[model samples]
Target: AHVITHYHRTIDKVTERFLGKRQIGTTGRGIGPTYADKINRVGIRIQDIFDENILRQKVEAALDQKNHLLVKVFNRRAIDADEVVESLLSFADRLRPMVADTGLEIHRALERGETVLFEAGQATMLDVDHGTYPFVTSSSATAGGAATGSGIGPGKLERIIGIVKAYTTRVGAGPFPTELFDESGEFLRANGFEFGTTTGRPRRCGWYDAPIARYTARVNGVTDFVLTKLDVLTGLSTIPVCVAYEVDGVRVDEVPVNQSDFHHAKPVYEEFPGWTEDITGARTFEDLPKNARDYVLAVEAMSGARISAIGVGPGRDAIVVRHDLLGAS
Candidate 1:
């Protein structure tokens, strides 16, 4: 499996709430601008760092331009090109030992009939081009990004597994139609321990919106859905799932393109009975409490994807693997 992470947004922009006017509390890893620069062709690639002179050239050009903007326009301190170059060089040296042509590598592995895995970081709804715009992330976070980022071609892709919380959540600035700031929202957050793994910021929590999941499943060609955090709903007497949205007088099954439409879209919830007690330690599907199993089946019906695996807790062992997602045991 190749685990790759995209660059984060700039420190200054994240705090300013650039798009949402909400304090996103982004990790400020410069992921946004880095991807922006990449798309703009001004960004540095890992391969480019191999040539020392080329590295220096790119760093100097970027720093010279950025420092000017920082001092003149933003009134921030200037960054030294030498320091940036040095840091990049250090990182490159570490990468130099580990880097390989993934194209050749994966091809060789497949030729040998070995199993390979491509794990992704972000969700489809957070994708820059396909997701909710302006509030979206920097890179192609969807399954399509796996091919480009991994240096692979289209036909080799056998399956794409999409992971989703049993309910829903979003981290940064965007129009979240199902977001709840109320006590029920608190219930989901508190019970699910809804927090960002990378940013550690509190995730915007809501119910499972089947329409949203179906949209993502379609766009990404998701073969299956790994419903995570299902155990969090075990103790509730009543659990709500968002099946559709009703805006104005119109009932909508798909997500609205406009932010205003989305913001105004009220979730039409389908309530289910919640089970009391914990099912986290249960390893087998047969061992799962009846209510828990019913919940999974119900979610599968609503989400429009087969629930392949269920995540009960944060530990690696906490996952209950039902069907083989990658077509390998």
Candidate 2:
């Protein structure tokens, strides 16, 4: 039994009421609010559900402030404390069986020399501390966040793998240096099926950015990269990859230190020859076309990490594994 921390409905309503018009393209699932409560030292944990009185007390305390904001600021109806308590209480019996000290469990497993795989939710550019401010997610999405969120030390984790798209795509409001406004963007969107899994929002597509990949690799200590959707770039005569950025008058080779500089940054692209051959069925690295292989190698050379795997198509078996990710060999 592993107790995974999850979002609460009360937190969701609070977030909704707080960010009335200035929504940062959230899934409206209260993930941000729940994390905020955890940080604010007022969150109700899964274990709290078992204790009805304490759960009710916490819910009432939270709503006392939330109701004020909803009623006065947002003009929305205040959520009832009794309703929230009842909702949480109903899930206690079912959730108690699953709740355990997951952090301790993980520590014990590692003590027995067992391997633990930690799969993170979001990308590096969406990280709160490192990413673009005011436009980033509330939680830490970087490698450091893995330790904090999972109650593990950073030294315990090894082999950080970054999943990068052959081209770039971002949703919601943010500064994209190489955002495409023409048919190239549309082509990538349609071909790559660039749609948000939860929000159903169409992603803003752009050319591949080597600088961003390099910067993420540096920040997250990425050992390998898994490049996806290379097949979508096929059939085009030429593909442009952003090698650097021109911020104001200077050519910046790395991510700008300031958000304002990044917002005004312009991409400096280097053209690569595109391939026409279908790569969806290619299983081996050598099976790819000369140009495709060249493109992969070129991108690898520019990016900080080695590309161990490449996704040619959208299918589960469409990946071409170049190297052993676990280093068992």
Candidate 3:
């Protein structure tokens, strides 16, 4: 694993500040810079901590260039290499005991008929290679990444379960075609509690984006989707779903090929009648209100894959499972 040095955070902050309005709206927790260090072949790794001399040398080498950029280019204070090494070394003893050949362990478990789940931290739209360029995360956030990151063959993977919001929400700066700027947006924000878990920043809310959902299904080979927060739209008179995009007078059913076109694309919505009933207690597909079922079916038709599960509310038991994710669909 690539280690996050103190300088990485400092670098990320300084660079984002330098960008000003052009900032990528990252968490500023040293993620991008740490990946940069990994690619630059000067990164401090988990193994480096066990060897203090190697850790110090790597940190000093990275800071040698980074400190120059900080002092001369950004007019910022130089980060001390000693402090960085010290901070990282402090966690070595605890982390070592837990580290193992995870790939081998997973492989053995599979051989013994034990199931292993690979969960991604970020969404498909945040993948570095597949998502919106220059506005995406530092790493892969797709099903394929699970295999590569875990040191498993792609063939070892069985099914891909995609978790999608009934309505879309994005944390950082990016092109959102169906983004709501009115009271409906506020309603979703308030009802869904659309706030970043760590930053507590308000997420940009939108309706169900079918085109993006289809794109994700194609890219990630999603077998099933868990449609969450259907209860949020319960009180609305109508719900608008983005079925396609109007890009320069042309209707595009998929995400636009060009970034500029995507940035300017306008959503073409298909409306669904809303329901008034509270669905938090409903545990089965049949228990849902007629209108809510229609909305789900409409979205399911537009979305590329089957919505195997529906989240009616925030509670753990609020989900309605139409299909078994671990079993054949």
1-329: candidate 3 lDDT, tens digit per residue: 89887888888988998998998999889999999999899998899999999989988999899999999999998988888888999999999998889999999999998889999999899999999888999999999999989999999888999999999999999899989999999999999999998689999999999999999999999999999999999999999999999998999989997999999999999999999999998999999999999999999998899999999888888899999999865
lDDT tens string, model 2, 1-329?
A: 11112224444555655766765666666677676777777778777889989888887887778778667876668787787778778888887778777899999999998878888788888898988777777778988887988898998887898999999999877789999999999999999999998788999999999999999999999998999999999999999999999998899999998999999999999999999999999999999999999999999999999999999998999999999887752
- Cα-based TM-score, every candidate: 0.89, 0.93, 0.99
In candidate 2, the residue pairs with backbone N, CA or C atoms under 3 Å apart (3 or more residues apart, or in different chains) clash, namely none
Candidate 3 whole-model C-alpha lDDT, 0 to 1: 0.92
Better of 2 and 3 by lDDT: 3
Ranking by TM-score: 3, 2, 1
After TM-score superposition, the amount by which residue 27's alpha carbon in candidate 1 deviates from its true location, in angstroms, is: 2.7
Native-structure RMSD, model 3 = 0.8
Off-target runs (Cα >4 Å) in candidate 2 are 1-23
Q: What is the lDDT of residue 52 in candidate 3?
A: 96
**Model 3 spans > 4 angstroms off:** none
Residue-level lDDT tens digits of model 1 in 1-329: 21112212333463355435465444566766676566656677787667779877876776666667667765667777676666666767678877877789998998898877888787787787888776676678888887887777866778788898888898877777779899878988988777788878888998888889888888888888898888877777888888889999799988887768887899998888888767788777877878788888987887767889989877888888889886842
